[model samples]
Structure formats: C-alpha cells, structure tokens
Target: MSAHDQLLVVIDPVARRIDGESVRIAKDVLCAGAAAKICLPDGPEEFSRALTRRGGRRPVVVGDDHALLRAVAALYRGRELGDEPLSLVPVGSVASVELARSLGVPTGAVAAARTVLDGVARPLDLLADDSDGVVLGDLCIPAEAAAAASVLHPASVWDTCRSLVRTLVRPAPPAPAPRAHRLRVEADGVLLSDLDDPVEDVRVRAGDGAAEVTVTHPRHTGAEPLRTLAKVVTVSGPGFRYRADTLDVGPVRHRTWTLRPKGWALTLPPAGPPE
Candidate 1:
C-alpha cells in the first residue's frame, strides 16, 4: 500500500475515557479501509512521541478538540503543519469536539473514519500569536464577558487598603458593578479603539488571508461595532485573560496575533454545492 493508505491512529486517553465505543468503531472502520497502526497514548508525552515517531504514515487523531489541538500544535511547532495533512475521528462530548465539527470534520465515528480513508485535504487559516500560541478557530477577549468587565481591573493602593478594611469590618461586601474595559485595539496598524474609549467586547476570527476583528463600545448602544479585516491584530491594556478556541490564556498586558493564510491542512469530506 502507498504511504497515503497507511495511518498512525493516535487515540487520546481522554477519548477512551469519554467514549470507548466510538473510538473502537473509528478504529475498526479505518483499519478495514486502510493499514492503520493504532497508538493508545497514556498521556501528552506518549501522544507527542507517537506522532514524532510516525514515519511515512499519515497521522489520524481520535479524540476531542483538545486532542486535535494537541496534534496540530505539535506539527506547527515542528514546522511541518503545511507538509502534513491531519485527519480526525472526533469522540467526545459535543462541546469538547465542537472545534473539529466547526472545521468540517464529521462527528460520527464511521463517517469521520471513512473521510480519513477517502477525503480531500483542504487548506485552512490560523492565528499565530507572538507567544507561540495557535488559534484554530476564533478568539475573544475577556473569556467570560460578564465577569471580565467586572474583574479585569488594576487595583490602586487605596483600593487594596479599602478592600482589606472592608473584609475585616464588614460582614458582607457588595459585589463590584460590571464596567467596560479600557483597551487599545489595533488592526493592521489602524487604530480601532483607544484606551480613552471603554470597550464592551473584542473578537478576532481567522479568515481567508486576514483576520476579521470586531470591537464593541458599551456607550454605543445601537451603533455598529468597529469592524475591519486585518493581517495583524494587537490588543493592549491592563493584564487580562482571553479565550482562544477552548483554552483560556493569559493575564497579559499586550498581545499580537498574525494571520497565517492556508497555514494548515485537514482531511475533510468532499465539498458539495450549497443547498
């Protein structure tokens, strides 16, 4: 058989715990269609080693979004993402495998396995951050919008003293009111919002050759959000956490993400005309 017909099936331990039946089904289908060497990795280290040791065989991940992300991240770090086309057999909770589904990978075990056996490799865009982070889908600032606006604030000396006094004297302290964040957002060197303007939300999505950015201001109730397409997006402000795909990252003061067009490839079912 050709190299393309040989697969290194990496089954994540989480997948085995979440849904063993689906994993079995996927394995059976892939093994029947192609020469598949199953690798039941116990943890992240084994998983990485399995992929690293795979020679001439296409890697097929059988797990959730985290599993898929891990595989892609490994290839990306090795600078082999473009050279290798990855396949997935998603076997986890709906929310856990949402990323794979969003990327056009079938959630069904049989369908996903069949796609791996006979499918087209499609080029996909991704966001690469300055901190060596990769975003396969979209990213949003203040991971939890409601909590972010209320919690992400720099406390002054007086504020800290007052809090301590309140904790010692008061039996119950009132919750802080939610407030807009003072962030500076820039898209491709074009300033979308400054620190003077309070922002309600910020989102960046990977597009064809650029990222689509949207910045919303709390003051502008009915006004449209500031939107633009840019190859680079930068957000600077007080230390804040953001959600990239399924991961919540950083209390970072500043972050920059660049769009890498067609940076990765995935094996997906053949495209059909829009219904």
Candidate 2:
C-alpha cells in the first residue's frame, strides 16, 4: 500500500455533535496517517450527495451505528457495495453502536480510524429484503414502537410543527409498550413457529450464504427455542414491525430476507475474530 492512498471520510452529524470529542479524535488520527478527505454533511441528503460525488476514493464512515447502516444502504442501493470495501469509525453514543463494537471494531476512536488505514479487507454477509433494504446484523420482530421514534426523523420542520400541533389538538394515548406478537415464521418454507402460540421473539442472522433463524416463546417448563438454518426466512402475521440493528422497519404482514454471501467487505484488524 502506498502512503498516497486516499480515503473519503464521511462524518455524520451525530459524530460532529458539539459533545462528540471522540469523533474529533478519530478525525485527527485519520487525517494524520493518510491522505484523507473529510466530508461533513449536515443531513442525510447531503450525505448521499457527498458519497455520490466521491470519485475514485474509498469511503470511511465516522459515526454511530445508524450512520454506518445508512452508508451501507446507500451504497447497496447503487449496486456498488460489492465492488468497494467500506471502513467504519465508531463514534457518538457508546450504547448505540454495540453492533460495530461486537463486530470487532475497536471502541476507541484512534484505533478504529487506524484500522481504516492499516487493516485488511474482510468479506462479509448481508441480509437483503424484498423491499430493497439491507441488514448487516440481527433482525428481530415485535420490537418496541418507541424505538422507532428515535430512529426515524421528520421529513422537514413543517412536518415536525404539524406533528406538534396534532399532538396539542388531540392528546394521544400513551404509546403501546413493547409486547410479544403472534407470527407464523417459516424457514425455507418449513414451518418454524405457529401463530397459535405467542412469539416472544424472532431473530434472523446472516451467515455464510444462509440465515440463522431463532424463534422464542414463553416456556411452561424451560422449552427451548426453535432454531434452524435457511437461505430464506419469511415471517407473516397480522401486520408486525421489526427492528434491524438500530432502525425499525415494518408493519407489513409478510416479509422475507435472502442471505447474501460475500455481500461486501470491511476493513478490520489484520489478525483477530471478525467484528
């Protein structure tokens, strides 16, 4: 590798937040070590434009979990993720990026940024849904609705103001607390869990060309969960939502995710477990 390797470092707004000292540290280390171009976009649209305008430069995201997901999704939509290996620098809220940390990204800002410059590119899998969405980690059904509020943003200030006005005009009931949902889960068309019994949880993980599906329910006497491996897993139930990584997506009665092997590559520590 040459000292002239150039990286397009896209810093998310959350990483550039006023209290984000860790993000600042990561930026400094990245710039000092390599020929890096930092793009600080104010919002999602700007982020997309910056990424689109990055010609012949590798992209390195500097943000928390959601930011990383968004970057991957943007590239995946353009059908460019497979050709380019992406790098990540985890910053912002610690609890928010458990996926990044668990994936072996150094929690420390400097170490993660250094990884962008010196680490090896590791092939990874992805869960691509029929709706054109991609999930890099576990996806769970029947997640808390309040979690959705935190991840989704209003389209504009007018939308925010309208929401506030509606809230004032009609005092809404308390949001429904998280609860189990009845679902019929099938792994490769084989029934895994029936809707007759309440499903406490449903998790789908991407593996090397397959998906690890886990279904959990209340046990009368320690009944074990139902688990299986499949290339595609479908969940159908009276409209249900799911949480993929940190983002919430759903309300559809039926959804399926196909496992993609070697979907993309990530810069990771040269010697260690995959993060």
Candidate 3:
C-alpha cells in the first residue's frame, strides 16, 4: 500500500483549534503526494470503537493533550498497539507539550502530519497500572488532589473543581503533615527505605532496569517533587490516592508499574532552540 493508504484520522471535538478548517488543512498536508482520508468522531466512545474496527490502518489523533491521552487509552483498551503506529497533532488549548516535547512534534498541524507520513518510530515508554490503566506521562499525588478523586466516574461539580484547581495552583512548598503511612520499599531485593516509622507518601519509579523509590514525611505542604527513570516501581499502602496526567486513578492498596519501551510513537512538531 502507499504511505497514506488505509490511514485513519480521529479527532477530539473539544480540542482547541479543531474546527473543520484546521482538520482539512491536516488532511491536505498528511495526504499530499499520497492517498488518505480523515474521519471525524462524535465523541470519545465512538472514536474508540472506530479505531477498533479499523483494519491494518495506522491511527492518527488530531486533538489536544487530553485527546491524545484518550487515544492512547483507547489503543490500550483495544489492544491494537502491538503492530500499529499512533500519531498525533495537538489541536487543543492544552497541547500535549510534554508528549510533543518528548516526541519532537511541531506545533503546526501540517508539519506534525509530515512527521506521521514519514513513518518514523522512536522507542517510547508507557506506564501500566495494576488495574490495566496505561499512562504515557506523569503521575501526581498532590495534597488537595483527593477532593477531585471522589467524583472521577461521572462528571460532577466536585470533580470539576478538583481538575480545575490542580493545574492552577502553584506547587505547594514542603511542610510536614501530621499523618503519615508506615511502609517499606525494596528495589531488586535491595531494601531502599523502611518507613515502618511514619511518612506521608512514597514513590517508586521504573525507567532503566533499576528502580528509584522515595518515601516522604507527612507535611502540610509537599516538598519539591522527584522525577526519575527506573525499570519497575511498586507501591503498597493502607489507603492512598494519585493522579496520572489529568486522569484521577487511585486509592489503590497495592500497585506496581514499569515503562514499556517502544510501546507507542507519536508524530510531534519540531522544537525551537533551547534558551
């Protein structure tokens, strides 16, 4: 088949700059010099079903960051990434800066499509949860994020507030909280830290083959957050909550995760020179 043949484009209706005109421009550019067509979605569920029914065609997403996350989640839910490429053009206000920054997608929709048509696959990583939720980006454990968790299932005013306040609030300073969870973390048989004593939260990250786990004391204000690369990280606690990207995921008792390299690749806009 030709480069653009059998390509399926799915866009998020709510994504920024996603009106018909921008999408048509992407269709023109991505299919230039080849044969292709773009399909619009009524909503996320239809988009997911459309992807599942698409046979052998590569799937491309034309939406903002949340849309991209939804697409990725759909692929995982449908189990279609074993032999397909997932491309994206961030078309919403909250662009996939972190995803695009990592993948090198340009901001211009046309340029982003060019990357897709070129068919390059980079070794990417995905985080898989015990509940089968796979995250391609950051996970959060903010003090006030819990309020948002309660209304995660169906859209509610409380959940809406939880989502709104998180990105708006400045990262809280580190101040110890009165309550803490006693726990133990082991990395490849090495006992990294044993907080049988008491601590607020713990983080176990898997990037390389090794693991990095951190346990923090209970503070009213959380300290500077830690980002790391490890192969596998596990967490076991009494009762806790966390957020992955924009999705509120847990109150999980025991959860473990690791990076799935080359799990999926996205087409990104090019980057400008660093400051």
Candidate 4:
C-alpha cells in the first residue's frame, strides 16, 4: 500500500460520547476515500496501546483537541514522532476544540476527514513541561487550568489513569472565582514580571526554537500585554495554575517549560492559510 493508502484511525471516546452522528460521518468520509483500520479504545491504556501498534500506518484522529493532544503526548513519549505527520478530524463541543480550530483543522467532520485524505503534511511546534505533558495551543496564567488530570488524584493507579484521561478529554472547566496571584515571570532568565506586580495574565507558545511569551499587567487604565521570545519560560511565586490548550497545569509555586521546535508534525489542507 502507498504511504497514505492504509491508515490507523483512532477515535476518541468524546466524539461518540454525546451523539454518534459526528463520528459516524467522519468515519464514512475516511473509509470511503482510504483503506483504514479503526480502533475505538475504551480507556487511556487501550488508547495508548492502539497507538503503539500503529506500524507504518499514518494515524488520523477523529475527535477534539484533548484527543489530539493525548495522542500527540503518547507519540511524543514513544520518541517516534520525528517527522510522522498526524491528521485530525475534530469532534466535540465547539469550546472544547478551539485549539484544533486555531491550528487549522476543519471544524466540520467531513471537511476534516477529507482533508486528512488529501491534505499536505506540515510541521508544528510544541510546548513541553518537566512533567510528561505537551501543549499544542497557547497557555495562559492567572487562568483556571486545573491539572486536567490533577483533580483526579485518586486512591488507585488504574482509577487515576482512567479518570485522569477522561477528565482531560472533557471540555474546559468553568473559570474559578477571580483571585489575584503574585507570580514572578522570567524569560530566558531575565525577569519579565515580578511579585510586586500581581500578574493579570500571561500567554506562551513555541516558535523558532524559543517560546513567544506575553504577560499582562493589571490595570484600571488600558495597557497592552508585554511580549517577548525566549528559549525558556519560568513562573514562580505564590502558587499558580495555567491553562495549557484545554487542560489546567499547576498550583505549584514553580514550573518551567521549554520550546521543542518542530518536534511534532501535522497534516493540513494543501494551500491552506497559516495557522
């Protein structure tokens, strides 16, 4: 079979969760255009297992942002993602997939699936933390990103992993009540914002081997967010949490993230506009 002839189609549970129509449409589009092997794993372990065994088949994910991110994270952990392009057909609530939309995946199930069958392969940057986690979209501080899996710190390992992946794949939780956090922000070791200045908000993304960082200052008057590019971004101060794509990141006093340039690849439509 040609490189794209046979496919490993991994469907995230969330897609078939509310109604099966979305997933069914995507599946029909893909199967009609290409020969594929579909795997509908029931849990994270099965999901991870399905991915590991994807020999030479290009993986086309049918789900939302979290499903895509989880697959990417799993691939990243295996260390075989070096130029292996991934295709996505986003399926879930609109808000749950803002990241996928921003990244240029077609929102319509048929559009996304057909694109996977015909789109050109492209590379994408990733923001990786000390923890074995990956972020595909912008991360914001002074935000409510409860560790997508953190709140699921349960009594058993099996329960923890299962519950964590489920919660992680769900829609973003509502923002918590407003509360100010005094945090120190540094880009490549240079202080950008200090504790004296209560952090209003901050955003970060990977680009050109460095992270493009933006920090906002609280104001009664209009003020633009501070922006810069650096290899490393460290946040420390009173405990804080950040929203990385669709999941929440921390409540710890310190966290550091680095840019991994073109560490992963994506499949997008030919002649598509930049994301």
User: Ten-residue segment with the worst summed lDDT in candidate 3?
Assistant: 142-151
List the candidate 4 regions with Cα displacement exceeding 4 Å: 143-178, 220-224, 273-275
Return the lDDT, model 3, position 196. Answer: 66
Number of clashes recorded per candidate = 0, 2, 19, 2
* Cα lDDT for residue 62, candidate 3: 81
Give per-residue lDDT, candidate 3, residue 172: 60
**Residue 166, candidate 2: C-alpha displacement in angstroms:** 39
Q: State the local distance difference test value for candidate 4.
A: 0.82
Give a tens-digit lDDT track for model 4, residues 1-275.
69777899999887878658989998898899888899999977888778879998988888888888889888888887664799898888898778888888788888888889989887888888877678787888864333433453337888778878998999977754444458899999999988987667888887767788988776543577899999888898878878888887667788888888887888888978344
**Per-residue lDDT of model 3, residues 1-275, tens digit only:** 75445678777777524466667777788677355556777887887887787776778878766777787787787677656667776564434445555445665666677767764655466777666677666654433322222334676898788867985896864554345555554444455445464555555443443444555655554554333445666666665677776677667666667667667755433343112
Our model 3 lands, by Cα RMSD against the true structure, at 9.6
Query: What's each prediction's TM-score?
Result: 0.85, 0.81, 0.71, 0.81
Give the per-residue lDDT of model 2 (tens digit) for 147-197: 434466647989988978998999777765556678889889899887887
Cand. 1 TM to true fold: 0.85
Model 4: lowest-lDDT 10 consecutive positions: 145-154
**Which parts of model 1 are misplaced by more than 4 Å?**
143-178, 219-222, 272-275
| Candidate with better lDDT, 2 vs 4 | 2
Best candidate, lDDT:
1
Which scores better on lDDT, 2 or 3? 2
Q: Show the colliding residue pairs in model 2.
A: 103-275, 104-275
C-alpha lDDT values of all predictions: 0.88, 0.83, 0.62, 0.82
Give the distance in Å from residue 271's predicted Cα in candidate 2 to where it truly belongs.
1.4
